[model samples]
Target: METREHYFNRINRFGRISFTIFFVLIFTIPTIVCAAYDIFPGLATVLKATLGLFLILTPIAVSEIVSFVPLLGSGASYLTFETGNVSNIKLPCAMNALKLAGVQPASEEGEVLSTISVAVSSIVTTAVIILAALLLAPLAPVFADPAVKTATANVLPALFGALMVSFLAGGDAGSVVIKGQWKAIILPALVVAVVHYLVFPIKGWEGVTILVLLPVTILGARFLYKKGQITVTPKVAKD
Candidate 1:
């Protein structure tokens, strides 16, 4: 049997190793691949565009996702890496990116207000863009052929596959390799996949799949927490 000290040491080591691998796989690999692709010729231009877009759109996405499931809002925020005081609203990176992109800043007071205003405007802009896309979807024939539409639909699955590969490449791969975490990952994944494809087809309720699965995920997480199976501690100070 494992001693308590041995368990603690293993947990700490695994935590560090897991997060280090996670960061390398998620961020570093993506950066390296993008660089290799030469998708954007100029690094400076790409950086500016990426920062500006992330800053302007992330908050909006956070808000929308939170609105769907208020209980998971904190999780969503954590996933998106949002920082700074939301009330005071400082977006330094975004501001700098905008400036680099030749967008003039407003006055000092305007800078503070601009952040809030832009975040709010982002929601409206996203909605308009979605609506415009939906309206124009019927004109797909005029813009692109059936082959292009099929390719566009496949992008989501491609991204999902990449994410799965990344997760497995860096996550508790040792445990999973030994089949310890396979049940955990497979159960949830199968539930989600089945609900998305099969249940939605039969029931015609896309949102119901999320509603059914999220609670199951939460319950599974609680079970894991109780059994000392999963531990996710925040980097912030705890009271």
Candidate 2:
């Protein structure tokens, strides 16, 4: 039987290898096109065009890795990042799976379930994308309808709101309650709102804002925890 450490080590190795393959494959297509058309942009021009986006996305990427890995586990983190759509699709899927399974995120069972959920989510999302692409022309009018557009626009907020409610209401294993856990978010959320709406007031900077606020949130949570404002109590399981 393989030990847990060995199993995870294997997962890490496979994840790295897979990431490398994907990295190469993603660039290969553009490289082929550029070569075929003899239209290679000089390194400096490419860098100039991408610099701003790279700056904005790099911090967000770092923040996601820092925040998502614990909930997602090793295998799921790699799979979710590689498949993309972490917040909208994979994270929600894994969270729901964990909730349904009543497993703590740091547990072995949770890791396995998270990986399964992410894999299933990826497969389903891919299928949906393909189906939507195929039907796009035929369904253009329906997709363009006012009702559809309105609903589509609100889907993410609605989904995340529901998730927030679930998380706040349901404790780990539906038994261990972390009292005053919501208070931890108060500071971070306030900061983000103030910066986003009052100060910066710009779109597409939320990720950068979050990266900056990460430490604030962590410190606030730690302070609350140390102050005994947040306390964890396990519920007595019934027979």
Candidate 3:
């Protein structure tokens, strides 16, 4: 029986080694390409461009990391960084795995389960991307259709809505806050609406959807929980 400390120790070792490999592979190719072409884009310009990118992405990235870590656990965190689609694909896969296994993502058992699930999802996603690239030409007509385009664009909303519904619908589930669902959903809904309709129109913040809503929703839930409006029993916490 592995203790919690042992699990984290192993995870920490694996994370460092894997990320080192990932970092090397990621940067080495770009450096090699520049050397091959004898065209090093100016250092100052590169730094400037990188700074701009970092400024734009840093807030979103930080928000995502904070929001997702509890749900993803340590090993899944490593896998998630390696895989690009955190919000869209990998998260749902990990959450579903936890749900099926009857474990909370923050639990000791969930760490191993989430890691395995994320690994499988990463493989499938990679394979699908490769297949999509190969079949893109043949599938062009299908993707070109307005219905398909509409469905693709609408999928994210549908996915989140379904997830919210699942969380709210589990009234009998002790882990789910029986009375807390509405405030959690509504406050975030308002926040998202303001961001999308009001702030997004101002330009430069279009990329901030779940990133902003995640914190707002959590804050709202915390407020409700503190006020005794939301009932999350200790038994539920263990769940």
Which one wins on TM-score?
2
Lowest-sum lDDT 10-residue window in model 3 = 169-178
TM-score for each of the candidates: 0.34, 0.88, 0.81
Clashes of each: 0, 0, 0
Candidate 3: TM-score?
0.81
lDDT agreement of model 3 with the native: 0.79
Pairs that clash in candidate 1: none
Error of 1 at 103 (Å): 28
Say which candidate scores most in lDDT. Answer: 2
What's the lDDT for residue 31 in model 2?
A: 98
lDDT of 3 by residue, 28-86 (tens): 99899999999889989899889978898887677677778888999999888778788
**lDDT, candidate 1, residue 103?**
31
For candidate 2, lDDT tens digit of each residue in 66-144? 8789889999999999999988889898998998888878778888899999999999999999999999999899999
Name model 1 segments beyond 4 Å from true: 1-67, 71-142, 162-185, 192-203, 233-239
How much lDDT does candidate 2 score? 0.87
Backbone clashes counted, model 2: 0
**What CA RMSD would you report for each candidate?**
21.0, 2.3, 3.7
